[model samples]
Target: MDLNIFREYDIRGRVGPQLNEATVATISRALGTFFAANGAKRIAVGYDARESSPIFAEIMHRELNASGCDVVSIGMVPTPVLYHTVYTADVDGGVMITGSHNPADHNGFKICLGKGTLFGEQIREIRDIALAAEFAQGSGTIEHRNVLNAYCLDVVSNVKMGERKLKVVVDAGNGMGGVTAVPVYQVLGVDLIELFTKPDSTFPNHHPDPTVEENLEHLIQAVTEFEADLGIAFDGDGDRIGVVDEKGRIIWGDELMVLFARAVLRERPGATIIGEVKCSQRLYDDIEKHGGRKIMWKAGHSLIKAKMKETEAALAGEMSGHIFFADRYFGFDDATYAGARVLEILSKSSEPFSSLLADLPETHSTPELRVDCPDETKFKVVERVSDAFARTHEVITIDGARIVFEHGWGLVRASNTQPMLVLRFEADTADHLDEIRDEVEAKVAALIAATAA
Candidate 1:
């Protein structure tokens, strides 16, 4: 088996090439063994709408059964629903077969143990067990359950949009969000315009990831054409959300976090809120100014979830669209529920979404830019950049290295899931932002040359 599918956060790889039946079976056996050792007797399994997901789930079920664990199959659903099963069902652990925002050819798993994420070293242990080729023998049953209706009802019950009747457009990017979100929106009494609502693994419109500007084109166009009050989009597994205002302007995750944080602070003053290091400084300033405690943590969904639990944070969000609200909803990232919460907050206020953002201070910033680097060399480049910055100036190493200068801050961090260095810069002025960007780019180039030498 190509064991690299055993990633830091979850097992993910190309369906046929890296994640064949044998490979997935081995992973299931390994997970079963790990859970059994930890006193787990029952596990939950859920799959997305990917073409390979059903086959993968069947193989996983067989392997888990062989390892002496009863599998509660939650059928095909969004990742959030699978996560919800872990809490609502009497399962020791749960696995969701989803590639998330990756391409359709890709499919893998995200796991949870009880209320916490089974990531980091836990993921590595599964690899070691699988590579050892150890298997446990037993007969366990696989039972199917449908939690979509219950999940939908729970979401509507918690989020009351009040009397503000607003028109909203939702672009599911042809993922599982269309299956669950449509029902929930229908029950919540919002005027809905659905785009790419059909569940298609082959994402005909665009890639499911809404964070990239290119992927959000269809959603923006539909928003403007329909003159909707707001536009929302979801990633493949429907755990992350991207949003646009009524005017078809991309609000971005940091700005969205500010809105969510503001709403949460009004209900619970001095509440702790967490944000990834990649978030804008304005987000932190705005939260603190609004009588909330802001804590900057590392990026990645698993890391952010763990931080949220540690801080008992009421709300947490990443620069990407992974927003987790622990206030009225579950702490896990649920884009459907988050989109509802956003609407609930906006619908209560008379001001337009654009005006709410316009009140904030403006600054020049670069969206996340990716620099090509091989997986083997990416971490080395980040280390070199960190070392160089440490030698000359102050740097924040909370995630990678955020080099702070007089004009602005420049960040260079290696993406955990890809072979690239993620960079972003922010400054009070465009010229200052450019200067910081240049300095960071120069450092990166120097690091690359040194590696080649």
Candidate 2:
């Protein structure tokens, strides 16, 4: 089996080549062995809307059961619902079969051990175990449970909307988000304008990823045409969110965190709020200004979640829209719950959604840019870039290279899931934003070329 599928945060790769029946069975057996050794007896399993997901899920169920794990089949649900089951159901561990914003031809697994997802060395350990192939043996059983309704109800219960009903636009991009989130919005009495609510593995409307601005065109148009309160879009498995304001202006993840952090701070003074290094500096500033402790940590949902628990943070979020709220809910990243929280904030206020951040300092930034780089060499390229900047400039090397400039900041990090280099830049002015981004991109390109040579 191709071991590269064992990523830093989860197991993921293209369907036919890197993942198939044999590979899936081997991964399942490996996971079962790992979980059993870790004292996990009952395992919750769920798959996303991808065509290959059900097949893989079945393989996992059979393999896990054969390996002495009683499998709780949660059926086809979003990634977050699988996570919800891990906490709500009587299970010792959970596995979500999802590619999570990748193209339709790809699929992967998000493994949850105990209450948290594994990352870094934990993922490497699983890969090592898979290579060793010392199988654990036993006969286990499989039980099916439909938890979508219960999950929706739980989300609805957490949101206390005001008397002002909301007219909202949602673009699910034909992924798993609409399957679960639509019901919650209807129950909340939202005047919902939905696009692509059906679960199609083909992703007929567009790719399910909302982080890329191009993927949100339909959402932006619908929100503007409807003049709705706001627009929300979810990634393939519904773990991440992308939002637009009433005027159809896209509100990036850092901006969303600003709203969430302020509300959380009001309820729990001095609460800790964690933002990844990719987040805008304004988010950290806002957290501190609102009497909440601010923490800037590494990216990736599993890494951020671990940090949140370590610091006992009330809230944590990524620039990629993985928002976690531990203040009044589970700390795991759930776009459905995050959407409800956004509506709750809007319901209580008479101001337009865009106005919520009107008082903050203005800045210009770019959406995350993914540049192709081989997984084997991406880290070295980033290290070289970091070293070059560190010689004469201030740089934060916690995750990759976050070079601090006088006017703004630029980041270059190797993606944990895909073989790519992720880049982002922000500055107080548009001109500075261009300057910073150009400078950083040029340096990155040179390093990548040098590495290739």
Candidate 3:
């Protein structure tokens, strides 16, 4: 088995060779043993709308039950619902069968031990146990509990809509997000325009990742055609979000966080806000301007969630749209919940979505650029890059190397989920953006070539 599927954040890889039935069964048993060892008497199991997800979830249920942990089966739901179940249900831990925003042929597991998802060393521990094959066996039971309705109700209760009703467009991209978001929007009395709401494992229409600009083509078009207030798109498994404003311009996650953070600071001044390294500088500055403390963090949902808990952050977000709100709701990354919160803020405003943050100084930036690199060497390359940059340039090595330039910044981080080095650059002008990006990209390329040689 390709154990590299055991990633920093979750176990994810191509389904057939890396995640076949036998391999999945073994991983399930390992998780079962780990959970039982960690004092988890009951575990929650859930799956997304992927072809292999249901079968994989069944394997987890069977193996976990055998390990003497009672299973709470929250079947065929989004990843956020699994997180919600972990919070609300009596279960001590949870496992989600989801590929997230990856390709259709990929599948994986997101594990939770307590309220938070596991990451880094925690994930490696599961891998070690699985490799050792020291299986724990016992007789346990599996019970079905559908938390979709409860989750929706919780989100609706937390969000207070303003006087104005909204006309919104949603592109679910045939993933499981629609399963939860559709009902929530309907209950909130939104004039909803749905796109690809059906759960299709094949993802026939488009890939379910809203992070990719190409994946959001339909959403942007639909928003424009409907002349909606805004457009919301959910990634596969429904944890991340992508949005387009009323003008059909994509509103990246950092900008979205600015809006959310400002709204939060207005009521709860001096609240702590967390943004990842990839976020815009304006986000942090805005937080400070609004009497909020800002923290720049690593770039993974599991890591961000843990940081939120540790710091008691009022709100946290990443460029990938994993927004967590601890203000009036449980601090977990839920796209549906975040969508409602954004809608609530927009409903109260007389300004359009496009103009909500016009006051923030504009800067030229690149969307996340991913360069293919081998998993084993990706971190080493980033380290070399960091070391080289630190000699002359000021750098922030919190999660990766974020070299602070004169007018803007550049970041190089190994993706926790994939075998790629994620890069982004921002600057005061388009020419400066290009100059910074070119320098950083050239350095990264040379390092990768050196590593290979």
Candidate 4:
């Protein structure tokens, strides 16, 4: 089996090429062995609407059963619903077959033991077991369950739409969010305008990722036409969210986090809130000003979730729109639940979404910038960049090297999933931002050349 499927946080690969039936079976057996060794007997399985997901789920179910772990298959659903099953059901662990925001051709598994993610060293250990070709012989049972109704009800239960009923547009981007979000919103009495709500594995409208500005055109246009209060979009697996306000302005993940943090802090003063490295400096400053402690953490959903637990944070969010709430909700990244929470907070307030963001200090910034590098050389490039910055600049190596200059900050980190260096720069002045971007780009170019040499 190709060991490359085992990634930093989850297992992912091209569907037919690297994630065929035999490979998936082997992976399932490895997971089962890991669970069995950890004294876990009951495993729940869930999957997204991707074309290959059902196939993978079947393979996973068969293999898990063969390894003597009773399997409860939850059919096609969002990743969060699968996560909720682990929290509410009797299952010892759960696995979801989903590519998340990736292209349809890609598929993967996100595993959870109890309420926490199975990642980092545990993922590596799973790889080691797979590489060793170890297997346990036995046969367990397989059953099916549907958790969509329970999940939907749980999400919309506490949402207060108030008397300020407003039209809202939702662009699910042909992802699994449509399957659950529409029903919940309808029940909550929202004047819902749906876009790409149909679950098409091909993702005909756009890639399911809502982070990129280009992917948000449909939602923005719909929001403008409908004069909606807000527009919400979800990634493929329905774990990440993107939002547009009444003026059709795209509210980025960091800004959304700030709004949520303020609302969360109102109820729990001096609470801890964690944000990923890519979040804006304004988010941290504003949270602190609002009597909440902010902790900057490494980027990645799994990493942020673990950090949230460590800090006992009331809330945490990534620049990628992966928001986790431990404040009267399950501390997991559920985009549908997040959308309801956003509406709940908005309903209780009189401020417009854009106005809330307008109050923050403005800074010129680039969204996440990607620099191509090979998987083998990505970390080396970051190290070289970090070492160079260490000699002449105030560099923070919390995740990558975030070099703090007088005018702004620049960050460069290797992506965990892809062979690319992610870079972003922010500054008070446009000229300062440009200069910082240039400096970082030049340093990255030199690192590439050195690697070639």
Candidate 5:
């Protein structure tokens, strides 16, 4: 097994080369051995609609069983459904076979151990055990259960959308979102417009990643044509949500948190909210203004979830569309649950969805920018850039380096999932945004050159 696939957040890689059935089977055995040693006797396993997911699941089932753990197979569902099963079934561990926003040819696993996500060094340990051919001897049972109905019912039961129903659009992008979202939204009594809701691993209409504006074009258009109140799109596994207002304007993840924060603070004053460093500073300020405590942490859903657990934050989100609400539900990032909460907020208000945030301080911000730097050198480049900036500017190094300027801020962070660096900038004005971005870009380029030299 290639240890590189054992990322900071989850295990993922290109399907043919690194994530083939045999490779996943070995990794599954490793996970099983680790789980059995940790006293996990019962485990829940699920897979996405990706073509490779089922094959991965079968192998995982046999391996986990071989390692002395019962496998609860919740087959062919969204990633969150797998998470739901783990909690509902009271399992000691869970693994969801999903590639998330990556293209169809790439796939991986999101794992949970004892009600919390398994990540970081924990994932690396599995890789080490896999390479060493570690094994535990026993034959455990396997059971199949369909938890989709229960999961959907649970979401509707928990979320109070109020008496007023919303007219909404849901674009699953031909991914697994439709498998669960369709049922949940239908029961919510919303005037729903379903687009590309079919489960097609090819992602025929658009990519499943909602963070990429291009994937949301069809969603935006659907919102306008349907004249719906708003629209929501989900990633491949349905954990990240992308929203668009009635006016066809994209409501980013951080902005969505701000909206959720306002409502949460009104209900529970002094609530703690967590946002990633990549989020606009405005989000933190808005939380403070609303009598809420704000914390900016590293990017990545697992990292944010861990921080939320430590901080007791009611709400937490990343710029990439992973939103977690611990106040009324489990702490994992579940876009399906978030969509209902969003509609609930809109239902209780008379104003347009866009108007809720009209009072926010406006600023020019750039979407996340990706720069291709090999995985081995990405962190080094960030370190050099951080050192140079720290000498003359205030830099936040929680994840990578975020240079704080009087007019705005610029962030350069290593992408946990890919061989690249993620860059983002925001400022009080367009010119200032450009200035800071250029400064950071030039410094990054110089460091990359120096590293090569």
Candidate 6:
């Protein structure tokens, strides 16, 4: 087992050296042992459209069964669907095998224990069990089941939509979202246009990540050509979502949260909503202005979900497009479900798609910026830079360090998934945004240099 594959959020790595049948099976057995020790009798397993995902899912089922846990297979589905199973199904835990917007040659497993995902130290401990080949001994059982129809119906049934007949385009990026999204949206009374509905492991059109502007370019073009009300896109596993307005403006996650909060607050007044450190300050400000409480927590969906439970928040969102709604539906991040919610909001309002966000205070913010720093050195570099900034600025060290300036805020944190440092800046103006970004980037460069020396 390669220790590096055990990330802070989910286990992910290139398929070549680190991930193979033996390693996957070993890790699965470790998970089974972990679950069995935790009093979990049955677990569910699902996979994405990635070429290796189904194979890995089968291996996990075998290993978990060997460890005495009855495994229910959901076949190929979205990551959120797997998460949905944890709540709707009778299983005690769940796992989803997906690359999650990574390159085609990469894949990994998102494991859950008792309806909650394991992260940080919990993920690292899996390596210890797998390396020692320590697994529980018992004969288990495996069975295949389909939860796609039930998932779609549950989402569609919960969300309330109007008869505005929303004309929208959905770009699945050739991922697994279309499997469930098509049925859910079809029943939602909308003139929905679907793109890349087929689940293709090769991703012949473009990568599945909707966060990248390049990936949303096609969605943008199609929305304009079709004169659609708006456009929505989903990542590989269909958990994260990205949006394009009627004018083809890329509506990021933070901005999307602004709309979601408004709708949620209207019904449940003064409800609490959570946004990560990298989210725009405008989001917090607007949420408060709307008589809703706002909490800024760490990134990562697992961390955000845990915080939601702690704060009893109605909603939570990350800058990278992970949007969680505990308002009308489940607390987990589901892009397809969120997309349907978006349409429901638009169907009620007569305002243009761009106008849905006109009430929020304006601020210029850069998309999350990532700098390549080795995993071993990334956190150290962030620490050095964070300490340097703390000496002068009012820095928030929730996850890494976020420097709060008079005009803006800058964040530099080590990415839990990759070998890099993630940065984001938001300011009152373009020049101020540039200034904040440069100041923090210079410190990052200096820290990297000091590490080399």
- lDDT (CA) per prediction: 0.89, 0.93, 0.92, 0.89, 0.90, 0.90
Candidate 1 wrong stretches, greater than 4 Å = none
Q: Which parts of model 5 are misplaced by more than 4 Å?
A: none
What TM-score, over all chains together, does every model reach? 0.98, 0.96, 0.97, 0.97, 0.97, 0.98
Each prediction's RMSD over C-alphas, in Å, is 1.2, 1.5, 1.3, 1.3, 1.3, 1.2
Error of 4 at 40 (Å): 1.2
21 in model 4: Cα distance from truth in Å? 1.0
| lDDT tens digits by residue: candidate 1, 1-453 | 886787878899998899888888889899888877777889999999899999999998998999999999999999999888887778898989999999889999898878788778999988888888776677889899888888888888889686888889999999988777888887878899999978899999898998998988998898899988899999999999999998899999999999999999999999999988889999999999999999989998999889888889999999899999899888999999999998898788787778888878888999998988888888889888988888878989898889888877999999887778899999999999989999899989889777867
Highest lDDT among the candidates is held by which one?
2
lDDT of 4 by residue, 1-453 (tens): 677788899999988899998889889999999988888899999999889899889999999888889999999999999988998888999999999888889999999977889888999998888888787768999889878888888888756666667678999999998888899988887899999998899999999899999999999998888888899999999999999999988888999999999989998999999988888888999999999998999988888888888889999999899999899888999999899888887776687767777888889999999989999999999999999988889888899989888898999999887789999999999999999999989989999889968
In model 4, state the lDDT of residue 68.
86
Residue range 210-272, candidate 2, lDDT tens digits: 988899999999998988999999999999999999999999999999999999988999999
Rate residue 23 of model 2 by lDDT.
92
Would you list the clashing residue pairs of candidate 4? none
Error of model 2, residue 416, in angstroms: 2.0
lDDT by residue for model 3 over 86-170, one digit each (tens)? Answer: 9988989999999988889999999999897999898999999999999899989989987888989999999989988899999
lDDT of 1 at 23: 82
Candidate 6 residue-wise lDDT at 56: 92
Candidate 2, lDDT over the whole model: 0.93
Question: Which segments of model 4 are wrong by more than 4 Å?
Answer: none
> Compared to the true structure, candidate 2 yields what TM-score?
0.96
Looking at model 6, residue 399 earns an lDDT score of: 87
lDDT of 5 by residue, 262-364 (tens): 9999989999999999999999999999999999898878788889989899999988889898878888889999998998899998888999989999999
In terms of lDDT, model 6 sits at 0.90
